[model samples]
Target chain A: MIPTIPQPRLLTAAYTAYVVTFFVFLALPLVVVAVFAFNDSQFPSLPWEGFTWGWFFGEERPVIGVFHERPILRAIGTSAFVAVCVSILSVGVGLSNAFLFNRYRFPGQGILYVFMLLPLVIPGIVLGISILVFSSRIANGAWDIAEWDIEALRPGLTLVILGQFSFIATISTLVIAARLQKFDRSLEEAALNLGASRLTAVRTVTLPYLAPAMIGAFVVAFLMSFENFNTTLMLVGSDAPLTIAMFDRLKEGSTPLLNAVSLLLMLGSSLLALVMIAFQRRG
Target chain B: MKAEARIGLILLLTPLLLWLSLLIVIPHIDMFLVSLRERVGVGEYRISPANYLTFLTEPLYLRTFARTAIMAMLATLITLLIAFPVSYYIAKMARGRTRSALFLLCLVPFWVSELVRTFGWMILLRETGLISTLLQWAGLADQPVEMLYNDAAIMVGLVYTSMLFMVVPLVTTLESLPDEVIEAGYDLGGTNVSVMREIVIPHATPGIVSGCIVVFMLSLGNYLTPTMLGGKDSLWFTELIYSQFIVRFNWELGAAFGFLLLLLSSLIVWGMLRLTGHTLERTMG
Candidate 1:
């Protein structure tokens, strides 16, 4: 076994070229979006006009920034609110489910585990329709009181959060469950042996270890809910998320304003990802 | 203590189970029932396979379904091929910081919405697109060539979007392989092709299977990329489902189509798992 052999020039060149080309392919589209966001031209593509901040900050007719736009701002607000609610709901359910699966050996656990993954397995469009119709007919009717107006029972932000949570929580469960798998049960046992109550033992020892994962899951779930379109599209009524708003505008015809929104979103996601990696590394 | 733990477990499991049964399981059962019935009279229906039969008999529905399946499969293969080298470079070839940076580079683009990503392609491949402009500048064409509203553009969009899903698994699996093993093959006078065939492929089969499965499912169920990039004429199967449910208000037919999609992808994935002898747990991630 020789430690070294000179690689053929052609093979090395081919491999290098292959890697570089793939990187460009992976990058060029998003880069195109960001670059075109600043183009003074109204078109999202083509011969570059001189740059302007019209899409972002200009107050004139076409230059009105997304920040100042009303519908777009409302859509952003709706998206953020729904995403936050979904994240919190998902993390709560997921942590409980994760605890149930990871800690105990229960009958039918296998069946429940498989059932949990069905949300991920089913198509988003199908899930959207399911939630939409189910809420409108069956679930809504069941929860509807004759004389009471329950704002939470409708197919708006509440339904959106519920729909997203059904699957996102399962994903969150998987993440937290993975973290839990590495835990030494004896730590909890040791706390118990030290005369701490069972609740206190879990609250102190196991919960601390699970905190990092729960936080990670929260961020991941929030981002997932924000980006989700197919399920959200059908489930949403009388209110639009950023994706639906952008989609409606795209159908009408796109402007650099959409690109500006995309640029901001891309930066936000990049920062979140960096923060996540840093947080995980530090933990 | 045991009784307490049992009560706690039941309490913990109740909400998720109730949630799934209400929102997921029952809805699907209802969808299944919807798929089984056709409108006999106003508000009247019977259990029959009329919807499924329509899917099988109608050439338009059948052709669209077949085409979407074939196209999605092709996109998965293309994504796998393109992502392999990038994953290998990051996992096997590159050193510490360079590897992380390259991995991050692969990831950062996906943070944008899928719609936005597809829109980027729209901007790039339109008649007056950057590529068309570049071609004219390089004297490769006389005028801006119309690149949009075509299958190739759709393929490009699908492949580009699915890159991350494919790369992550491949990199995860490849990362665990000791360099000494590859070096050993080289020392044994194994040529590149033989070594890769005997060593790399076998070791990477799980990652490859998982990646392919995920990409295939995602692309098949995807409604955005094909419609956006391929324009009105794409006739993607998901679009047909959309029209059935939303446009035509034919939930029975749409339910059938939706269930068929789920069944088809599941069957293909199941068959692949059996063929490759991979487990659901291992391939899922």
Candidate 2:
């Protein structure tokens, strides 16, 4: 409903307050982490003990404290590796699924689509547990039958990537499918009529149109995979992802170094997003 | 029709089919089998319905499911309430660069991880945190308020996380409404409140329902928010499921709980579609 006489000033003031408050809520923890990253204190809580760059690039041999932890770095690297793999796998799978579903009409298509979406509806914890138990059982049963040692079935990087890909691919499919729905089918038809093969038509016309959406889907999937904790925590064997590492640290006790790690992650993601946004603008 | 097209379809579907089979279908089949089995000592399985029967008969597990359902409903309702006005403001009142900027601001929270975002609320609600400090400074409380690690904090975290999901869809629908229709209401001597109640609300029903469905499903499935914000003793249904499988090594009971959650969410999604007069496919699309 449109009011005849608009309360412009009041509306603007209220909106400004809301926006400011939202940003405050969003930025407060980040600001805390960024500030605490430079804190020389052992604790994550306040009562600062001056400023130091020890956390960021500290160089003492076998450095003690939270700054020089090997596991934390390893976890971060593992998370990055897993995220990349999941992103590539999800995007590839999602794109093909999108193309098939969008272009074709087939029997039980509705049922197939529902099956695809099952992962999104199911709880991550349940998925993780089921995958872990199922994989272990299969590995053990196979080994007992063959009378051979098979150690590769343990949950680790592979399981983490697979678990994340289960749902993240669904997200990618939905994003790309939505974009595809708006695509000009006539463009592809025209390309085909103008002597292009179906593959050539898709490559020359449809693929370019879907590029931005695919990229967006990739970024979103990658971020989701990277930040995923529930599935990763359940399925992680010996090597922890970054989120699990942080959770372990928090369980032990909160330290400024944890905050420092959070700060680094925040900075890393924000920079990546900024670059993507800039590229989008240029394109 | 074409051989190449047929082959393309097969190639496209093969990976997805294999993925779903391995990761989803196979695991679910295994879960169903395990659900029929009983835990015999540490890390052993035996065929029995003992765990399922226990979940059904036990008051604690039953109560946990009920409470989780109630909490999820409350969270969905609260998110809808808060998101409606904000979505309306953006979709109706704001325009030009201001609207785009405001929309971007709404999405900025998505950039932060859910774990990190929940952590933000934890810091705010803590004894020595900003909220407590503010209340103390304002003389509204003699001491810092004890608002953290409760059902209320859990609701806050859930609502905050699911809010954007509600807002985005609402904005899409509300933005689609023609300004002329709204102005015509005013021209016909209809009051603003009546116009909204009679016109805008009806038009926005589909979006509201879709948003509510998404938010409800997410809230019902959420585990981390309740665990972190509500603490160890929260007794959320998902947490119960997690405990059963991870801590107790009881897959059967966990499967029952998981099935219950899936059933509830599906029913809610069905109800949402029926109420909005839209199919699930349309709403999801």
TM-score of chain A of 2: 0.89
In terms of lDDT, the best-performing candidate is 1
Cand 1, B chain, TM? 0.97
Q: Clashing residue pairs, candidate 2?
A: none
Give the TM-score of each candidate: 0.96, 0.91
lDDT of 2: 0.80
Q: DockQ for all models, in order?
A: 0.55, 0.48
lDDT of 1: 0.84
Q: Where does candidate 1 stray beyond 4 Å? A: A1-5, A139-155
> Model 1 Cα RMSD, Å?
2.1
